[model samples]
Target: MSVRMLSRFRAITHYMKLPDDYEDSQGLQFRKEDLNQREVNQIFGGAHLPAPMANKLLRILHGRRVAGTLNDPNLQVNTAQFSASDQRKALAYLRANIPVDEVINAGLRAEDELKLLEREEDGEQKPVETSPQDLPPDTATNEIPIPTGRLPRRRESDSPYGVSPLDRIRAHNIAKREAEEKRLEEERKKREEEEALGNIGTLQTQQEKPKKLSPMMQKMVERATSDLKEPPEMKAWERLLPQAIMTVLIFAGCAAYAIVYTPPKRSERLWPDIPPAAATCLALVGINLTVWVSWRLPPLWALLNRYFIVVAATPRPFQLIGAIFSHQNFSHAMLNMVGLWFFGTRLHDEIGRGNFLAIYFASGALGFMSSLARLVLTDGLIYTTLGASGAVYGVIAAFFWLHRYDEFKLLGYPPDPMSGPQGLAFIGLILGLHILPLFSKKAHNIDIPSHLGGILAGVVGADLVKKHMDERARVRAERLKTMGTLEGVVQVKEKGPEKAPQTAAGR
Candidate 1:
């Protein structure tokens, strides 16, 4: 027999020795000695057979031999009879001659040919298998079978892992490239949207515009377009009127106090000249009077100055509280009072009266310290800084930091165009007016440092408290998220009971 035939015979014998499930039992069963030449040809015939059947046939012919009597033409034979001893002899003959490598190569070749023929009969292209001959001379012979799914088969150049190492690296590079492209696309979209909103009427034609408005329409349009146009600032008198009336009433009350209970002066003042306790009592009295009469009076600038202003740098500590109620002018007093009214109302509502008062006084004390620090640092000599402006600026800062998202507009600026931060920025810009000594040349006359100090004190105080508020909000959000997840689980559990009735009815 040829080497190929001997290999085939050995493979069949080997396959038959596998577990029972892998064996085929069809056709003739033979013993070792009863088998003949006709049975051998029948087992190895050209008829197509499954792997199991072919293996069983080869096993039956394993060690059998051709009888000399069967070679004679006149001999009668029973086609089905084969002895176990004869089968063993044939198998032993084939195994003794066949090489193991030839057997493996032939089996693989046959499987490949069978697949190719099946595809061709079905009018499909046959896939080529990678072979030892196709590989480089130095390539290793031991290779694992590559996994293939619905995707097309790989070329010889492809790695056995289906994709080349370089291809995997290239794929990762492509993903990064795509992510960058998407980010740029989103940024471009945002810029386009902003540009479109900014040029609202650029695309509109002149004729498409509304005709000249009637008087009513003009007023409506004016109101609608007020945000687009800046308005004039309040005149000094208009701003100061509220403070001026309050001052007159305060002076009248002080004149009564002087007449009724002998007012003290530099020469006639009680011992310990401006006693600390007395000074504090007087300051509180003045503040109470200011608040009282200012409620009834139209403006209180003079009253504020009398109660709060202290000129000496080393003045009694009580003067700090006093200084917060003082004002330089009617405009100063009115502005401070206006700020207090606006911010105090909302803050008092949110934080409650007690906390509001605490914050207000704490803010005033901080502002006073800031002013004192500024004086100590900037000038060797102490100069008095006075004004409710510091305390009120603190209140405004607190409001802004606490309600940063709230929309606000300056008197001479657009409405809803500014948020709390923008409003604070506006205040800073106005304060800058006091610092422009080169341009305005009168910044030295104004206590710019005191104002800045008070603003900073207020910002710091408010920020400290606001942090606690923000943390509370964050904790609450997390709790709600966890609660929602638990609720979903409960709903799923409840659904089990609701489905049981339907399932039982169907059964």
Candidate 2:
């Protein structure tokens, strides 16, 4: 026999001896001597028979021959004769060796194959024998028959325990290879399913093949994908660069304008003549001393500083500034100081010392100006005002503008006093507290015009501060967005190869 045929024959022989219950068989179904030349030729004719097919054929021969059918040339192969166990084993055997399409084409029934294998393995085949004359005409050559008992035993060296070690190794390797292929196929299918589900649009992958990404391109794609999922955080450079640039530009522009433009002849100093804080303290001290002296001496303040009181008769222009500092009694000074303390600290912190002082004095000046205007327009009357009520009202208005969204409540009557209609109600409530005194039998002096002027100044100041801060925040937000977008673009460019592969895949 050729080497290929010899290998195939050896494989069959090896499988036949694999079952350990060979001794329990009732007897041989057909001895090797029963196979005529024609049957032997049929068994060996197929070249490169897979090991599984060869094993199945061997089992079939043993089964038919032992059933006393060795001489019948006209008997058709009856697949139903194989039991359920035999069919399953046969089909499994075929599946391992061939593609699923070929296994189906081969018409191997797993159920029936398994049954035959099981029955034959149980040593259930009955013995059957025939003389040479009983064989078909072509197979009945009158040669002397060899008895079943005379069959040759496999040599100990030919196989270890009647099975070749080399065949076991080959079978093991084939099984491992098939298992690996199955695993890879399963993984490929799972990946496709996941990709299909992830896509929002119609899946277009049926006709398109995926092009593998090159290493550099793959890294780019990975980075871009990550960026798309999670926005990159703002780095220190991103946060500070715009602010620095803007600040530099502002300073440079201011310096250029200052250099280019000359001012008109000075009417007064640009800054306050005295530091605002120091000026305010001295004014308060002077007022307190005046009150003390007036109470003790009685006639000193009335004669010398009568013009300090803001009234139509003694209304000196300078008294607008001076009257702000003076007080008729301690109670008047104390009340104005309380208002200053409440609004001054916060305005100073928010706008800086320079801006705070500017707002304080500017609001106070505007307040008194409004009062002066009102006094000039009114009919002849004596309306004396000697407190910082108008300037304090300006501070309160600034607080309202800055904290418009803040909640305010009053007397537990209406909640959210600063919102919608409730805000209007609160305004009316405040106006009633201040204005109703004008009609009272003995009304205390209240500077309504100064309060109105202060409110206007405070609103303008708060808006300016808010506008400046908001612009800074807006610029920072824009810078962050631009940096993130640019970073994505840079990463993509660095991974140029990745885009090419993805483009190819899309195509």
Candidate 3:
């Protein structure tokens, strides 16, 4: 496409989208519009109500406060004073009678009333003026009377300042009206803005100034904020069913396939024969590699990040499986794939491919489940886990468990085999490396707990595989023994206690 066409296409896309400020009242049924503590204070102070009505309302508020269904000790619910707790409760319960708009109007009245009272007070405080005509009859004795009382205020015309008192009062009234009009105009604008944006809370929020609260009141207010936090109503078990079901299928399918299907003798091929354990390992490595590579692409990273990592806080059970096959870093992927190739193929060759896959997938799934349990128990759901280290650990641990008795050479065939004790020491060293990092605060990124869970799963998988093999071996031996006895019995019957058959030459 040409640049102009592309730009036009972008504009169309932008216009097609709903604006960011658009909102719907879909949740209006569950939504609440409550008066905050400051709005409730206006009612208590009776700024807008008559003296009798304000007193009655206050008494009613106090009565309702003491009788509320939920009592918080921190709020001092029993106190006679209008405690902060009372204010909180009053705001919550009295929102019906004293809505936010009513409070705002009361504030509007308050400003005007206060301005008039201030003008009157200033008039009273001014020094009284004595007109020359009001002078007492010049004391018969020519001594001017020393004024003992306040004199009358100077008339507007007699005032030393050029401005008349009526003009000043007119200006003050005009200023007061202008301020009131400005307030009304601002509120009108806010209402219009709210209508355009579809936010009903805008008018109240802009009109009311949240009072600076004392520390105790601050704590009480914070405590009340829990009302905003939705309760934990999610059905986690439903979300987790996919992971549990898949893990079970892995183990069950392994058992069923290994026992029920029998490969014909000398039928082995690249097509028919079950691939070596390396096949499963390499397949898994490829999956992880594809995920890792995809993550590097700018267009796909967002998709990978959203779906691949199993975040404990989010209900994304399928991510439990995705996370096992995901790796974002090259070094992490290489190390895990290397470990799998080294140990997994050997383990697979001994155990059938079915059992090998069972160990790998089941271990990784259970490893994440184990980590999930830890996060929930310790309240650490904020952590997100993604990698194949857990599966790799399970493969390594299973290999070690099955070959516990065998001497192993780590470096070269010429090197001395690390016998039983030496092997145990090496395993211990590796385990310690995983376990030690957990105590340090800086090593939070390392998922040592998941590795430990995988190790446990590997040991269990190894034991089960061994028992299955032993049981299959016993059944085969019993069948062979029965066949041998039957063949002998058949030969005797064919002879019929005599020379039933002639020599081969006679025939």
Candidate 4:
């Protein structure tokens, strides 16, 4: 088998080995996770722990939970981000703050609980896991009966677990909340079903009392909703595939158009009757301008930003396309439009409108995809990027490639057109300005990846077009060579060999 086939086989096996969703002994479905930072962080934060403590704990958990080592009995989970002395100091602080008897009793209780767990895991008495503070003080003694199992969540309201008035009041509040949560879950399911059945509008029209949520309940709801979501990296992979598909689809579209469609003959046009190349440029500018104007409409701002901007945090693959013709402000929109009109028209006139658009859309999509890939690799997935600079760069690069030796004007010219070498130097200067800033330690909003990708696409696109054109020219020349002996036709002499003169060629 080939190396690619072997790699694919290995990937399939790896995915097959990944832990899947399964039901526990209680018939409750549990999704086994290799790692989910958001789920971990949410659960940790929901526990009312200090942010610093939760963060530190997470670092330690992550340090020990290496990807391939998961479920490996040999891999001990003892290492932490904190050094030995720091951990020692922390333990000492805890010891100083907590009572000695309480600590000793807690340790004893914890040890007994672990012993019970081991026995239960080995098919002996089922063990119960309990926090030391939650149990009675007598639980530390040998005479205290070992717990058989854990208390089930969604407990009975009337179950007696506390005695004091304050405790009773608290339990009552918790019971009320549990009931409310159950009701909300049912409502959510019903809403989902209604929406799926296309009856959501009717359902929404029905009068229903608004449910009031306490701050605690609101936090609970937020945590619950986000808890089951897959990891950002996983979702990122899902989004990446669509963007890749879109890029390839665009490329195919461009290729198909170039292969089949022929442009109409070029003709001079009067004012308002724009040339094909000019029309194409104007249409692109109009698209950018329309999106830019939408930025001003407050109602559509959220929708536009979400759909138009390429956000790393919540990436939408289609945004890569939307973002190409999207500009946030007037200055940015105008700058890109001017660049498009200047270089785009030149390239468009040289290439047909279809081929020009092929280069434009394909370059832009590929450019953003390249940038997103780099960002994901570096864990800078929270970033955002937008604009047509990448597509514009592509146009510039193609134009530069086509007109390499063409002399052009420059800033305050000394009555002489800039030489080919001068133009080359000027192009390098602009690219260098963008490239040099990336080396600095400071954070920059500039998108180096899109620019580089665009330039590359342009250069490659130009080379391919040149190659195709040359092939066609060669084929046509061959065809002309094969067409011989046409009456009243003059034959051009070959460069290499001289043919014998034909006296009666006109007959």
TM-score of each: 0.32, 0.33, 0.48, 0.48
Predicted candidate 1 versus true structure: per-residue lDDT over 34-132, tens digit per residue: 335454545444333343444444443331111111112221122134344434543554456432323332333344356656766898753554432
Model 4 TM-score relative to the real fold: 0.48
Q: How close to the true structure is residue 313 of candidate 4, measured as C-alpha lDDT?
A: 62
Range of the 10 consecutive residues with the lowest summed lDDT in candidate 3: 22-31
Instruction: Give per-residue lDDT, candidate 2, residue 102.
Output: 28
lDDT of all predictions, in order shown? 0.49, 0.51, 0.61, 0.61
| lDDT (tens digit, per residue) of candidate 3 on 309-383 | 876655365666788889888999999999999888888889877777777876787788777667655666567
lDDT of 2 by residue, 195-283 (tens): 77763224446335467778876764554331223323444344334433543343344334423443233345343565444444455
Looking at model 4, residue 244 earns an lDDT score of: 76
Task: Return the lDDT, model 1, position 472.
Answer: 63
Model 1 CA RMSD to the hidden true structure, in angstroms = 37.0
The better-scoring model by lDDT among 2 and 4 is 4
Summarize candidate 4's per-residue lDDT along 1-507 as a digit string, tens digits: 655433221211111121222111111111222224454345433434444553454333222221222222332223233345444443343335322233222333344456666766888633233423235557456353322122212222444762455754575466446545766898889989878766674546453434777887676455434242433556556757777787788778877876676766445333246778898898899899999888776556667766788876667767888999898878877988999999899899887776788778777887898888777767777677899988998888877876666666656554555433544555676679778887889987878899888887777787677777788889998877766544224444352234333534634
The order by descending TM-score is 3, 4, 2, 1
lDDT of 4 at 441: 92
